[model samples]
Target chain A: MSGAEDFLRARGLWRRKPRGEGWLLSDVRLTVRGGQRLAIVGPSGSGKTLLLRALARLDPLDRGEILWRGEAVVGNRVPDFRRHVIYLHQRPVLGEGTVEDSLQAPYRLNVHRASRFDRQRLVEWLRLLGRDAQLLTRRQRELSGGEAQIIALLRAIQLQPQVLLLDEPTAALDADATLAVERLIDVWMRQDDTARATVWVSHDQQQAARVSTKMLALQQGRLQGGGSC
Target chain B: MLNPTYIELDASRVALAALLILVNGAISLALRLGMARTLLVASARTVVQLVLVGMVLQWVFGDRPWFVVLGLLMLMTFIAGVTAVQRNQRRYPGIWTDTMISVWVSSWLITSFALLVVIRDMQPWYQPRYAIPLLGMVLGNTLNGISLGMNALTEALVTRRDEVESLLALGASRWEAAAAAVRHAVRTGMVPIVNAMMVVGVVSLPGMMTGQILAQAEPLQAVKYQIVIMFLVASATGLGTVGVILLGYRRLFNADHQFLYDQISE
Candidate 1:
């Protein structure tokens, strides 16, 4: 895989004090090239999740510039940029109805109107996760935590984002489910003709070593260099 | 075909009605409701405010100047907006300005449409007798609806911030992401008006209709007028609630469609 494709980059990224408090994140610099899986590891309150959210443009940044394919993501382009750079939380918040409803949500947005829900694609992912097409009709309440996370992953994965900013995507799962997720992501990253990337925030060191090709550590909102496993 | 002269309440009769407050105070004391002080203060405020309003209305009706009418309407709208804002336990950055504009635009549009197009008998359109009371009714009801809706909107955003952010991450614009909370708020604001409409005559006599009947208008005529007012009220409340939600949601984001965390205090 070519490592030359800088799919997403963040420069001088920091979060301002919302009120009178200190910065939650400061002077962070990071880049994710195509086919790269960068893991961010930190203790709680270390701003690991904050950094990922900022990259996805979900959180307000104090001062920063995020670029997609070397162009700054701004204004009317933010939605389009977001369509390709998705963020997933630890516990998914599902909309009302079956898993199918949650999967079909993005196509309803004007920014993603050009795309349609591909049930075949969803079934393919579900099959990889040891499920079948029948899982699509199950209500949100019926799904376990692992199942919910998988659905949330599929929701973003189906969108075919260039970079997936996952904030502990597998932290709430069991061992088998965790492996399933890791494998699903492996297949997903390879499916794109060009390189796709991920910034995974995980507290589990072993999992981090397994999933990430490169690693970064965050402490008190500052980024530091690290080694790949 | 009823007697045209309205039944006038003499000073004695008015005083007799004022004594009804004493009965309420006595009941509060006897029941140990701890509401006697509130009752006393509220009664005093009501008497003073209504008397002052009565004199001002008399003056407005006598001369019927356009500016004075418009000035009074603006003042009413301002007070309504502030009242709604004050109802929120937490404040957003520019919520006061947001609520004021929402209230004024919705109330003015609906009230004018009702007076001019629906009830064309009020020839000058800003005739103090019709305009003042009509504006007051619409503004008052709209205020309550907007307050409930604004409160609901804020609470939903705070509690569901995760869900909202998730949607935003999924290429949803600020509007699409916040659409659920907006719809919920607008519906909440209009629920009171809808409930009132449902119980208009069979369950209870609405205030305006009862007042019209007491003023010796034909009961049927009073009912017709009450229906018109109720329709105007529903329209105004629905519009005001929607305006406040749309504006409130817009303010929660910056120009770049990023959620403005600083704007949310709760």
Candidate 2:
């Protein structure tokens, strides 16, 4: 029903029995154009996280197709797709070192080992999210939920992926922390005009209204619009 | 050091050794009735197992065939895997992979050290004195090491998984994120051996030393051999424990560097 010029696209894709314990995921289609912020929200067990995994290709789908830059992201190439199209979960899985180690994470990974990150760049992002410089040198297990979420967001953004997927990025934070994360999300969408599209999942109505230009709510394994901005 | 007469171990001496056994057994029993049952089972099993081993050792040690050593080595691997499964709940894949790698590295290291380095002139039909007992000691210690390492690694993987993934997100390869946990686990798991090595002679005489005395070896000879075995246990524990954890963590994390959800089903 639309022109096929999107940067990230998924159509008619499904996944089933991923871990072989009789668990399954199917019927997932998602797309995000460069600079667009799309939120996919639904209750637990409605397959929101599974759909994210399927689209990112972290978990396999039994049917349909995912396209990155118009090429089918199927077969073994799914791994490459998942790598470049980043995904973040509710709890930030921070590494075992200082704040600085996490911020420079992408550059150390195999996929992005050639990339570079400067302290100032991270500091710039941190400052935008209203964080001080001391947050970077501190240990991983020492950070508060809000700081960790921001650091995780900062790490994901550092990858500069074509599309970023977030599942409940601030679900574990307080009201002030949630407000801070909301601002970070807002800043991240405006990070660069055509840098990376974002697909954020949340149940917060005010958040969905704040920064999301496009929205989809999952119900019984299908997406429904929620007053798109 | 004293060569107590054979008659020195008569009724009075027998009565004294019996009293030591009974005292240790009683204290062990008071630890817990359930654990007491387990400890008793372990003691009985050890006695029975070593006796059965003694029966096999006659043929194995006397014949000293390479094939016999090979067979024993395979049994060592099997025992290591079964022990790892028992400790780690290894119904899934990768657990065996870790154990196999650990056994290969540690057993080989200890065996070569024993045969080529320590007890040189390893006759084509090596003395079971040098080979069998050493293998049993190394294999048994490696089993405990691998189990402890697997415990530390899996616990770190499942519990602090978010930290691991975050490290990956931080841009660490699967290996780097896991290295912290692996290193942490290895340090923790290897502590008992490390501590034991540090405090060996000063605090208490170990079993190997005590056994050598029982067999009437000279004090100097027994102490020297005890040192060698203590080092062997530490080396095997350190290397094998680190090996299993690092390798296991690599498999647990995927190619895209995402920590696989449902990694541990049981």
lDDT of each: 0.86, 0.72
Candidate 1: residue A85 lDDT (0-100): 92
Model 1: per-residue Cα lDDT over B147-196, one tens digit each = 99998888888888888888888988888888888888888888999999
Q: Which ten residues in a row have the lowest lDDT in candidate 1 chain B?
A: B1-10
Which tens-of-lDDT digit does each residue in B150-180 have in candidate 2? 7777776777866665454334555666777
- CAPRI classification of candidate 1: medium
Model 1: lDDT to the true structure: 0.86
List the candidate 1 regions with Cα displacement exceeding 4 Å: A1-3, A192-194, A225-229, B1-4, B18-24, B64-66, B114-125
- Residue A44's lDDT within candidate 2 is 78
Which pairs clash inside model 1?
none
